[model samples]
Target: MTLQPKNMLNRLLKSLLVSFVCIIVLSIIINLTAIKLPILTEASYERYLILFLYLIVMIFYVSLLFDQLYLSQKAKGISLFFYLFIMTGSLQLLESLVAQINVQPKAIVDVIVYTLVITSFTVLIFRYYGKGAESYTKRIKNYFSHQHISKWLLKCIYAIFLLFIAHYLINSMLTPFIEPYYNGRYTNILKMSHHAGDVKYVSMLTHALVMVVGFQPLFALWKGSKTSLLFWFGFPLFIILAFQPFIFNVHWPLGFRFPLFIEETLIMYIHAIILVHLFYVPDETHKEEELVKSKLSLSNW
Candidate 1:
């Protein structure tokens, strides 16, 4: 959270190295289990091009994850496990389910194993390359911070509404460009009701809640450093949702998926900055300063 630009670059490169090693190990595991994943085996010009961008995006994501988890707050062992297997895990599971194509038990296990290996290496990279950094100087609070239950619920409702609007409006605008690629397959662009029908609303509800309860550590980062906001929040969400379609789908044209990537990443960034403003706890010093100024004005009056 408090890194110099050069150190940030260093951490990114180191984390990328760790991630590549993890990917190698994961590839061996998948091969041993005899699970053929298109993401690994298939290569095309478009695929490789997107894959290269994905790696660039992931290196920063991993590095930022380290800073947000460690320098932003105290990252306990239990908390690290929760973020890896539970917080981030939920988002991954949702996207993976959406990406399924005749998934077998082995494929499911491969996904779980891949998650384990990559997240585990993320921790190792943090320990060796980033463990002792100074904590962020700002007082940060997120949805998990103490608040009246009713107010917390209001924030959740507001977030859900915002997300729906953002997604609906963005998809509406991009539908023409994106619909060409759908090719009679579920003519609707957003696909909100694709397989789940109305049940997808429940899924969206869970997605909102996941942001509330699972991403407290990230709320501060969302409000910091405008130059990096796209990668800090948007890129990770975009990459997760795009990985299967943009990089792995041999038949799906890149032109189709690229718009979704832009759509989701834009929404994610907007959501992050907005939520941080609406619900996050105020900085302690900033809060005190406001209090003092208010009292001084009252006394003068």
Candidate 2:
């Protein structure tokens, strides 16, 4: 389906409006239930607003970019809910683990309940809309041929490894200059040294992986067609999403100064750009094959 600019704008505005209302309602629910979720209690109103905006952007990214994968609106809605739940749940789980944040048993139960509800919704959606529908697996396999997929996977792996190395090297080099500032701000308060260790490495890897994988839909849509509206929307959106956390101070596993933050975020953008280029760069042979397939499909229609 062709997404006109006006339609895209309307969809985005609707998503933003709905997301705002949902955030308010969710805040009320959390307050009423007295569940102790991480970051919800201490965060300011502005932070919550940023979080809601990010959630809406993610929904847009999935719904518009991967529209072909789902059979109907119901499937798309269920998938969006699943993605939101999994994304927030994974973040909570990771924060609890790495940041040593305290999460109450009631909160854990709440998370499980929400998960089950969404999972059930997903099953029903699939049962109804997915019957005799083209599976996402098949769609992906067709869009990205086996050879392209293999090559892209290797490139992603190499890019990630290089990212890790650059992260280590950059951090090491900047430690002397930035350590004093970081130490002054957080060292005594957190009672942790500024030196690198397992936690730092683990956090870096986690951040890099999340950044790369989170933008996979954007990559896929761009690869399918550079002229796609989804590609145009997603390209800048991806960059903004990468920088949002820092902009809002939403959550950071470790503390650092502006310089370090900019460096790290730039590295992430580079990683994403490399992955997109490696996966989407058009070759004459692949273009010819795609053109032929397009003609055949059109003729069949």
Error of 2 at 84 (Å): 5.3
- Candidate 1 structure quality by residue, lDDT tens digits, 43-76: 3456445544555566556546555534523443
Candidate 2 ranges beyond 4 A from true positions: 1-5, 34-63, 66-133, 143-145, 148-156, 169-178, 184-195, 206-223, 226-241, 250-257, 281-301
Q: Model 1 off-target regions past 4 Å?
A: 1-9, 34-38, 41-53, 71-89, 92-108, 128-146, 180-200, 220-231, 242-250, 285-301
Cα-lDDT of candidate 2: 0.51
Model 1 clash pairs? none
For all predicted structures, in order, the TM-scores are 0.67, 0.59
Q: What lDDT score goes with residue 138 in model 2?
A: 54
Q: What is the C-alpha RMSD of each candidate to the true structure, in Å?
A: 6.2, 8.0
lDDT tens per residue, model 2, 120-213? 4333322333343455445456546746667767766776676567666666765565455444454322335344366667755774565456
